[model samples]
Target chain A: MRRGLILLGALLALAACQQTPAPRQALFVVLPGDDGHIGAITVNDGKREILLDRPYAASESRGGVTAPVQTSEVEVRQVFGAALAARPILPVHFRLYFQTGSDRLTPESDAAYRAVFDDIRRRPVYQVEVVGHTDTTGVAARNQDLSQQRAASMRDRLVRDGIAAGAITTAGRGELDQAVPTARGVDEPRNRRVEVTVR
Target chain B: MHKFVWAGVATLALAGLAGPAMAAGAVIGQVKTVAGQAFVLRDGGRVAARPGDAVQEKDVLETGADGAIGVTFIDNSVFSSGPNSQVSLEEFSFDSSNFKGAMTSEVRRGTLTVVSGDIARSTPGSMKVKTPTAIMGVRGTTFAVQVKP
Candidate 1:
């Protein structure tokens, strides 16, 4: 019995000698959302779990999981500057109105067009989707053609503004999707508009 | 024309094997920005990545020592990675009408930045990132991850 205990102790000592501290293999940092809302991240390393709920909260794993820690913005910038710099801007949505029975833009929509164009131009790369909508003022078949014309016209305007024609796609949804639900033959300014989404 | 036809056939075959999240070559995202040497590995082929390139599920995004890349998903989620990185879009599905979906991405190595979009915002715990050591459940947040070799 004594010899067996001695052998077991020797095995334990040998096992201890073979172990070396493991290096940190990963790092995770939680940041705030665009609207300044701080969300949470639940991290599981199989053995333990961490909930990072605050901005700049961080966690790292070595051989074993570590407790959550509060990191600084400076550290994040220094460590993840390249990844952050590569992040693309979120999408933007714009609406432009049109005159009744015509593809011409209203005066107010014409004024709003500048900002939309500027926003698209400011991005390094963008994809524009122009969807034309019409009010329930005319027959569905004619309205479909009219909406298509409005969409094509808007696409032409963007092309004229120097935006690449290949980067923009246009679609027309006739009185099917009215901004304001209206009875047949009713003209709704809100529905007679083109929506542009830039990404 | 021949290449396009073969590609469609291959996509259809892979879609059958990829389960539900992938449906006959659906475009899940687009490459918004790329610098230096970035590439997308899809279906056993590695091609240089460029802005405006379509990104599909099961694609592996890789960056060289001097490279960086950014991708924007249909759900509005954004993912960017620094040099010497390998990230795989394991699974993704989005419903435009409801703006709800589930996504899972795995970072094999290097640095990654994630901005959760409608998927995580509309349904918490539906978006996740997997690393060598841990799995993170993102709840409509922006976050950074680094994996060392």
Candidate 2:
């Protein structure tokens, strides 16, 4: 019985020695708004000091709306690290407002778009999808057209900045797909936005 | 005698006007194939069509409206057209009858996709889709057409 106990203890030690540690992954999150209000970005990774508080300048207007300036490559890497650590790198959807029936980027969204551009540029193997959506206000047909135009405009901007055009696919879901639902004739600010996904 | 002659003339004019009106032509089919507007009939026939062409029976047809419409063909091909798209099916046909036919269509503007079925395969090279800038030939498969006007 003592020999058996010693054997069992030895087996346990061997098993413990063979155990592997989980991989170290990182995650970062940033929320930028149109009202010149840039939300706090947090990065959680051991051995890496990411400055998430960098201020992105506001730049040219899209569809008569000023979009926030583009984010740098360093910031994008931090965010990508965070996203990869949290989950499978599926596309994340965010809202960007535009002028009604126009493809111009708003001032607030410029910075976010820049960040997105930076992120896509850093990852060459990844593909980007830009889907535009609109609230239910006008005719469904017109809404679909407008939404598509907006999505295409955004895609053009990305391509101009050096991303391969083939890697991007733009779709206008129209009012048929809504991120936020509201009453009829009610213009929801959140609803009139573009959703971008990096896959 | 003069009044009698005038009444007969009026009757003849009325008959001529009513004859054609009763059988007004409809867009039988439209060209939605590839590279150009073309359609094939069920009996293994084909036609070349262009954008803004009227869709009629006996003509393979497709359409794009400001709204949505569900389209089905004799060969069981289904297609959906989004708003503001210009679509037309120009040809349609079955191959079990000896594989002799052609289909064609055109997209002036907008977006559309075809969910090709047995008909597309049975009739290879028989399907053609035309956009404003390019002509697409289908090799027994499904594809999409988007034209920016």
Candidate 3:
């Protein structure tokens, strides 16, 4: 149903290539913007010109009736994937913070662990990077060992969650790469964390 | 000779961008992971997807109940589609060296998250995702969209 329109658009693009081509119109719309909350989206399909003002503001009212007829529009994507099919996909990077001195995930970040798992499970990610960091609070040497323990704990948890243990690589940055830079012996909650990159 | 000349020009243009050498039809990205009942529809045909499957431009992607999928594009743009969502990649043009290009896709229903890439970073206005009522001109590093069906 929706697929026909997309095919028609592509065929038209090919046909137009032979004729005096119009600025290649996408079957879908491409918006321009200046601000985040207040902006405009223009939909010009040759004949129809739509200037939607503050579309985000209007979506709240019209969201209930949302359904585009064309269901499957794919192709422009394959051109890239097919072009570099041989190149490896880059790993996805995610960061989760922990408690100040403990290896336990922060209450907020613990909730975020599900999202990280979802990302891992969505793809055949062979490499999982779990690097732990700590606030500049303790001795640098001890912080390194503590951070490694934190990293190893995350690795095991990912394994228990179904990812292969062999797929994981762990490291501990200790007091390095603090989210909020501080002088030595400073306690920063944001600095205590594990960074995960899945490939 | 004309075809050869045009091909030569295109090669030069692509070389300037350090673009990937594309086949007659290229696959822009691949499905890195899939869960539940996700499907890929290409050429009017629908099939379930698995890890390491390629996702081409002009392909319609959908996720059923209990389904989800993650995709990574050549330009480093990542998309994650949640259950009951329909998405399409309508247009894309990327220049590798300058990292300047445009990408346009649409989601008909459900949830989708896009992690921006070179195209969006270099030219923020070039990345767009349209839903039923609104078109999103992505400006941030990452964003999520939810369209009501």
Candidate 4:
């Protein structure tokens, strides 16, 4: 009976140690975005609020209270290496310029579009949004048609490059949305362009 | 368990009616990359996740000790979770015209990293993450969360 009691006491002690585990913790860290800009984060734990605005800024909340702390890239990598490495490909944007009053791509833009096409090909699954714009030199209605033609032309090239037809969407903003605001009937090279966003 | 089985049946029926591409709920994102053992729990059914798989709202992502998964949302928001993590997409919506949206995710355990996108940029504080101990709000930023089990 004495031996049994000793065993029971030892088991109870082990249980006590197991039950007093470390307190639950939640850590939040802010980092620079893909665009190289740092934004802010707000953490609320019902009873308190903490703000982390700078890159590598960090905080830990325990038992519903939080406080800010210093962190470095090395620490972040040590803790979140897998999660960071698993980050998805960042969205890419391309602007292809067009010749004045036409849907034909400028020589420079023609070379640029090959890079965009190659990027789209590399992704196993991609969604493309092509928006075309025209300079203010032409009539609004005509510019709208020309802008749409420009977008459609780009879409056709993507389709020929083997992108699924359903994966691409096109829009024509025409002179209403110019890269450079200009007086009516002004020919702005920057405004006559097609913007493509691939994700 | 019975409730989950029934929910799975219902989801299967809806998928048949609407087709896979137009799966019952709104497809908020896609699984961009998955390594090792990862699965998406939807409507009580656990499906092995693969690249390009559509991720709907309310789906739970589970990653094993050797697993990791990345997701990219319609609003360009990107997120990924490390091994042994359970993350749930509680709510998500986006308006392409206005670039306004709200996203709320829950990290039950393990680590998650996110890069806020157009939605968070256009409407600061609209994106949030909930943990066992606290809630995090993103204001057009990149952030990471680690929830200890």
lDDT of 3 by residue, B7-109 (tens): 9898667755675443344667778778788888865558898776777877778988777777877567778776777899888788643568889999887
Give the per-residue lDDT digits (tens) of candidate 4, residues A72-119: 899899889999989888878899999998889999999999999988
Angstrom error of the Cα, residue A101, model 1: value is 5.2
In candidate 4, which residue pairs clash? none
DockQ each:
0.60, 0.01, 0.07, 0.62
lDDT assessment of candidate 4: 0.88
Ranking by TM-score: 4, 1, 3, 2
Candidate 1 residue B55 C-alpha distance from true site, Å:
1.9
TM-score of chain B of each: 0.85, 0.54, 0.81, 0.85
> Lowest summed lDDT over 10 consecutive residues: which window, candidate 1 chain A?
A62-71
Could you give candidate 2's per-residue lDDT for residues B58-132 as a string of tens digits?
343322332333343334343544444446555545542233455566655555544444445575556666654
lDDT of 1 by residue, A1-199 (tens): 9999999999999987898547878889988778798878989998888988888889987866655666799988887888888898877889999999899999999999998899899887888878888999879999998888988999999999899998888888888878789999998999999988888
Name the runs in model 3 displaced over 4 angstroms: A1-199, B1-24
Give the DockQ-based CAPRI class for model 1. Answer: medium
Residue A48, model 2: Cα distance from true site in angstroms: 43
Better of 2 and 3 by lDDT: 3
lDDT for position B107 in model 1: 94
B110-134 per-residue lDDT for model 1 (tens digits): 9999888879989778999999899
Q: What does DockQ come to for candidate 1?
A: 0.60
* Candidate 1 TM-score, true structure as reference: 0.76
